[model samples]
Target: MSTAMSAAWPYPLLADMVLAVHFGVVLFVIGGLVLVFVGNRLATWPWVNALWFRMAHLVAIGVVAAQSWLGMVCPLTTLEAWLREQAGEASHDQSFVAYWLQRLMFFTAPEWVFAVAYTAFGLLVVLAWWRYPPRVARSRG
Candidate 1:
């Protein structure tokens, strides 16, 4: 049975923990956009349009795009890799969650491809901001 893990990989637990946090961040960045559209059309999920939430989402993706264009790895990914190497190895096969999240988060792609995709996605987020601008709900007397 082959896996992303190598050697004894003693830090499988910590590595998986980092991987889970990374996956959650990925989901927030992607899902937040999806909800912005869905929430607006349905006139539900008012929190989606909150200024703070929108700004945070925008900043999150902006950083990702800037990092890609500048040829920088995500800090979270760097930390996770460091944790894996600390024990000389970590195994993705330690648990079902780890295995699947690892699969979902990683794929082989050229650097330029990622840079372009991130930039395009960042543009879409900007467009969303324009189309469905965020607002703070004020109290009604």
Candidate 2:
């Protein structure tokens, strides 16, 4: 019976789930750009009320972008690919964004490309930060 259960769950689905979470976080960072431009709609969310959270999110994205730009591989992508390989699954192979990005995260990029991308992402991050300086609570006496 125990062997059956083990066989049923041979792969670590948890790692895949974590990869999904990483993807979601990436989406949020990109989407947050739209939110910044759209309006104060994000403020409506209770979570957004926390300045620290916003700052952290912004920083996290900035770091990811920086890593990408520096030609440094993303740990999450490497881990995901490794997990897939371990599970006897073929890694992604294609072009456009996914193929190349997956490759970039797995294999390092050229210095020039990394520099250019990093610079661009850094600019975007700066713009976003300026637009939405973390909200501060007012203290009433």
Write down the RMSD of all candidates, one decimal each: 4.7, 5.7
Candidate 2 lDDT: 0.61
In candidate 1, residue 42 scores what lDDT? 96
Q: Supply the TM-score for candidate 1.
A: 0.85
Error of 2 at 49 (Å): 7.0
For residues 51-75, write the lDDT of model 1, one tens digit per residue: 9999999999999999999999998
Question: What is the TM-score of each predicted model, taking all chains together?
Answer: 0.85, 0.64
* Candidate lDDT values, in order: 0.85, 0.61
Cα deviation of 127 in candidate 1 (Å)? 0.6
Query: What is the Cα-based TM-score of model 2?
Result: 0.64
How many backbone collisions does model 2 have? Answer: 1
- Give the backbone clash total of model 1: 1
